[model samples]
Target: MDLSDLKRLGHRSGTGGWGLGGLHETGLEEVRPVGVGGPWAASGTRASDAGEPGNSTAIAALIRDALSADQVVVREVSALTGGAIHAHHAIDLRAEGGTVPGDSAWVIRFPADPSFRIGHPPDVEAAVMRRAARVGVPVPEVLKTGQARAPGSVAMDRPYLIMRRVVGRAVASELVGLGTADGVRVGRRAGEVLGRLHGIAPDAGVVDGLIPPPEDPAGARLANLSRALDATGAVEPGLEWVLAWLTRNRPAPVPPRLVHGDFRSGNLMIDGGSGKARLVAVLDWEFARWSDPHEDLGWLSAPCWRYGRRDRPVGGFADWASFEAGYRAAGGVAIEPARLRFWQVLALLNWAIIALGQAGRFRRDRPETLDLGLTGWRLPELLFEMLRATAPEARAEGADAPPPASDAVVLPAPVPGVEDLLHAVRRALSNGLPAGPEEMGLLINAIGIAERATAAGGMARAGADWGDRARSIRRDGIPAGRSAAHHGRLLAETRARLTLANPRYLIALGLD
Candidate 1:
């Protein structure tokens, strides 16, 4: 189902479960649940013969081969949700004559298509985790890692990494549900862990395939954003304004350190089973790189990563003071507020561009799920927030202006209009259906988009000339004495788009 369905099921919409990688930003939905005694119980049948892609039997065999175990019995395997780029499975198995002791639980991470991975290779990720573990960072113990095999190779189809499953919750709803006190505790621990991770010198021979330290980190980031914005082929004046703002306000350079590219709440596994809550393991190392250490802090404190708790700057769990206290306690360098704010703005822009790429994937690859399409709906919200963060003063210029009115027109005579057809489809999908929750959620979201589009007459009614405006801004820069009006126009355009995508979001932000 969509994020709304996930919320209805008592789970928050942003953070995800085990091995979700970047997809943690998008909510997850389960299609079906596998029982304790599922199809993997059968003997003498290969996973391919059973008509499953990554069946339990095949995984057991892979483990056996990787660990050189005498035997491996996969007791159960259940598919975890929130895996758009990679397939994550929680597998419980008993191993004999191997390094692993007794019956243990573990997670298997492998991509369906290895080429689509945006991070380092599986082996590189495992090595990075090993390096982080060396510096007392809490991380999953890598059991086995295998690279992608060539076609016709008698091995696993894709690159895979197996690790001992640390017991904890990674979902944002559960983490935030622990209350402010516990969340602060976890946040302190997270800061300490990040501090330790950042202590690693970039020159250290940690592993291959990591992004090397750039000569100018801030400039490098801006160059990358420029390329990504151009790649999207859609002009975003809000983002263009951000780009210009960043160019004018570049941060001072510092020595590069290892950066956990996606250090935020969902990626942190919190062990709250005990009376006290603490961070157990930091996950999703595929996006790791070498950059300014403050990049991690900025990402952690970004508004979008806070999961609706704007009061707490650090992952919606703890205040900045507590997080900084922990950071200093762990030997982290003194943070500069101006530099931190720069990275924070960069983080929001980066995520907004990534959202556009996700929507592009949905349109080009035609993935089975509606998560990508829904992710695109987040663009307006992100842009609005970006503008607010960078140009808050501009919002006050025309803050009381009336919102754009809907342009939808009603025909005098028609048996079933577009709106009527969309409403009927939405009703039918909402009713009981043969499809599971995941499929039903996709259908529901698709219908919702259509309904919203119909109501707005179309989705592209805002800023038809944004491309031209963006080009002018880039060529000559935002003229002096026109910043407020420029930002006001961008905000209004973004608000219109947000009205179509999610009006409730506008109300929540007090912009409606």
Candidate 2:
């Protein structure tokens, strides 16, 4: 879609669209608003300073201290888009003296909020990147890293990692829009990169400080999901059923390998400058860990990561055959279909929990963030997929079919209706208001939720006590020959949620 269309409908687009690829990246911030000026646009604002939190002066000083340089001149520091938990700034600097590189472009990364840190610290990430680079993986080189400390202790106030910036587009929409030829080529390269990454032996020093793979991967993951669900304190019968199904169908254990926990389209930096899209660097190693290699494969192929291109299973670019070929050509082990499917289901479950956690984080720590609040609303979508994937009927008859269409609910329009009120506010905001893309997205989503909830008559449709049913299923087992009824119940319950969370999603999937 064009920029104007994105601005009007808040649809998914390359630069600023509110749909799938736009707001879905794990921790990436929303794109800058359309028509907004770049960092250098405003008068009196020096190129060397973008008014971002990490100012050039402090960064230059930090570089000077780290390199023991006599002088360091920071030419510019501009905020890069797409980092939710961490803030990323591109730094251009020239240094003179002690082991200094003459001139360079680098990226400085640190937690947006120090208290909301996830995964390993900066030092460990630096070490992991170094190790990955040593093993032939395309990754940025870490120049310096700082540990989190009390205020006023250092020039860089937060724990941070500085690395040489690699030139490439990491946006998912842009990558997926590259068409079939480039998709296959990029997908193959990604597979090759991942193959090499997973080739890192379990005994390697890189495994230090990283969470090791569990003895029983499926069981451990199921238990973790159960605990996370409990923590959310939200009743999720569908998830419970999926949990029980997973418990029964645990895959046989395999040897552990280095897994890029969040390996997917958005996290991959692709360079198309040479005419063909190629994987230049694998980004976002914060979630890297020791686990079943299939975990990485499944995550790469997960439907959610496809950016709406479900046909191309491997990151919305290439088929499994091509990706598998690349992996094997790079000396990776052969993949088993059953194991891959198992991990794919687990991946969805893991993502659902993550969505809950992000929503919780928004409520508890960052109430002002509309993005996190929206993430919580995504659980229904995630859980719907989980139910479809793990339902007993799906196991018998294939699970690849699209969800069947259901009748759309019609609602009465009352005086001063909530949906109408939200639509009016949205129009006012979209017309001439000084709202940013983030604010616009929030308003659009709020309107969508209001409209859907209004149509559905409420947030949910009253029916069976799903929580009790879930408990029984988890305790006993899925009833034999009742797969049809089970599937129907799942569809009904999930559709109710989707109505409130995203009616467009239901329509797009042919469920409405």
Candidate 3:
């Protein structure tokens, strides 16, 4: 943390800045403290003034004052997770002179940048979550909103939310090797949650600024990719083609409902001890809204959430059979399998772009690190596989699903000399900027792979040859899972790179 960071945090009047690595150190210390938040007070400011820290201090004081007023005695402040959208922390509070209170915890959200997407509009999310909870969803309760808790807390015009904390592991990363029974549970619970959420009716006039539904079904998927790509700053040309094709031939989807715009394994927290993810507390509402319900099913099948075990179905637990069964049990209306594949392809494509945007942010210094950036480099290949898997069905009716409209001609198989088969994967991971330790590991592997590919003159090989290679590997017990992992890395890098690569992105951020 620089003096600028200190100055920027000037919102909470009298509140001191933690400084660069201090904030993270504070977060890490929570697990096993070694002198973190203690009695280290620097009670003076230099003569030369910096307004940044003052802004943060003022906001801090504002919030502390709010807690003071409510007689909620806050003991300490620490960081929390807002998933990929925000950097957040928590506050430990005890009762004071209030009506009802004791030891309780509340989380505080902070956007990666002044304008980055965080959790959600706290007020709205609290309302929806509260309603959803009543509607049979296992969501957390809201204590007091961070915004409402402080007046004039919008120091940088940035938003933060506070909520009651809950428990569970990320269903995506953890439930990979579970059996069909566990898979069925996840699907059932997820379906139950979605059923209730879709059935919700937003408050009157609430659809204020949401993206409108596309003119046609094709338009919807293409629009989704276009918007995601637009945020990513730079997208591989192949994905652009894939987006076009999906859009041009977008199947007629069924009815639109309140879709969990981000439904996937990672967003769900299941109870491992229970042998099932009983606590279906849906996490991350940054993308939640009213949309097509079929998208949810497709989203569940997205390669990004598959946890690298392709054979393992939804949540990497059960196959489509179990997932669809659970969904149908929850009163879900079945759509065509090909349509599901379409959404599945779209889901991976969208994720790749979103990851690209994150990579851009890190590259631009908008985020702490390429925490979720790597995904940008991995999604395209997964999308390609998804498209290929459903190609027969997609083309069954003889419907011409032409590639999406774009002026960029497809490059000579993105991974030069590499077979066309791996072209999509190569295109998805167009570029990246590494920062995290895991990301650095990926970079090391990628460099080695690239070196080997170059030496082997893989570029001379056609797309069909690459397919043969992948098939041969599959025969030898390799799973042929390629894109999501690479895209994950690219997502982190693309966003980080964009801080300098794209003036438009910087302009949108008002940091230009």
Candidate 4:
């Protein structure tokens, strides 16, 4: 789930929207490659030789025992990528004429690290999938769900859930390039599928009480976001401003529904062929919950989730009108424009908090993931979007804010410039090192972190000035003529950040 290669995964071709999609398809179709196995293995090393606990050998043994069949032989295990919270691997095995078929490809999902869990546990995720499937939500079929080390066994330490392999790429970069017509078709289909998902009632024994239902969904989210922001220990003026705006403009509440908390382009599996793309499966139920149905709509339509195709509001692939038509056509509730915007603003704030947490993973949690570290640096764009959505006055008359004070200074690291250093390191990871699938994934993350780090100096300086301006705005109130100037400053700072972190997206969005 390297957010960096989203565009490269899919592309347009004359023979229809379908192309050789997915970086994992170079090895496994559904998942990305795992990082190099050991603490420090050079490129091209095998997982078995890397000496990690989740090495192919240990994983194969764990799978064999979980099946409890003597005839089963685990042949090969390759680490797959694209999961932010879990370590995914494709398990190739021979059943040898047992109840389980022979030469089958299965997936093993295990915790990436014990410290980075925010959703349901493995066992609960399995049960929720089952319940969701019972209600016609298309999910991969779960084969077995178990902890890595069952009570007395001293085997693997992580809990794992196994499922039959399903083909299709969820990476938006790969999906969006499937041609405009194909993109529309996939978007509508996804909207319809999401509507169907939201229509499901949480009456099943398994889903009931799975997670404590928030009595006041919006308030609960705000409270959680407040805590999350506090945990970040960094002052985000945009986040603070948006939180205040949301509090002041609270809308009439609605009943909660089963919501796929993270239902964006990257979480969908698109099966492409003959110039058409169909959503074959919905992935990532980690954030599934009982909440306002509008939350899902807003999340799906959020500017951040749109990836590079901001014009197409629905997951960056289809128009809001078509997506809403598909949703309402599928017997789901109607979209309230104001409510949707409220949730969209909330989604921005939520992602901002999550981004801070991702950065924290590298900073404090010792995950050392490039993905997490880079995510922290991309906050300016999200904050910029928040300013535009919730405080339109900030963009009034297109005026520009005053430049940063002369006192502004950023800690300068030695050697090549940050951007140059990042680009050099990323290039090295991509071509210099021969890495295993696990190592490859880590490399992807490393490149992403480097990409963001390229903007560290600018972001630090801009943030300091932005914080000062925000205080003045709060004290003097957003002045009628000055609001536009403030917005200009926000946009300029955001664009500067994206130039280093995601310059391609800026070019695509015409912001460059």
Better candidate number, 2 or 3, judged by TM-score: 2
TM-score of 4: 0.74
RMSD of each: 8.0, 8.0, 13.9, 8.6
Rank the candidate models, highest lDDT first.
Answer: 1, 2, 4, 3
lDDT of 4: 0.58
Candidate 4 segments whose C-alpha is farther than 4 A from its true place: 1-70, 96-103, 150-155, 204-209, 360-373, 393-397, 400-512
CA error at residue 164 for candidate 4, angstroms: 1.1
lDDT of 1 by residue, 1-512 (tens): 11221222121122221121122223432111111111111222223212244465576677777667788877776665434455666777788877775788877777644444445778888889999999899888998888644344223568888888777666555564567678678877887888888888787577676767888988888887787666655566667898998888888789988888778766777765645888888878876878888899998898777666667878777788777878888888779988998899998887766556555544454434455445656677778778777774545645644443334321111012334335445555566562655445545545655676676765332243545677888877766787776777677767776666556566656767
TM-score to native of every candidate shown? 0.79, 0.80, 0.62, 0.74
lDDT to native, each model: 0.64, 0.62, 0.45, 0.58
Better of 1 and 4 by TM-score: 1
Best of the two (1, 4) by lDDT: 1
TM-score of 1: 0.79
Highest lDDT against the true fold, candidate: 1
Q: Can you write out model 4's per-residue Cα lDDT over 434-481, one digit (the tens) per residue? A: 445644544554455454554354323335555666566545554555
Query: Please, what are the lDDT tens digits per residue for candidate 3 over residues 207-288?
Result: 4433444445446557645654544435253354456546545787545565656666556666665465463477665555
Residue 332 error for model 4, in Å? 1.6
lDDT of 2 by residue, 68-186 (tens): 87888888777665544555667788888867659877777766655444566778777778888887888887888986443332234588888887877666656667767787788
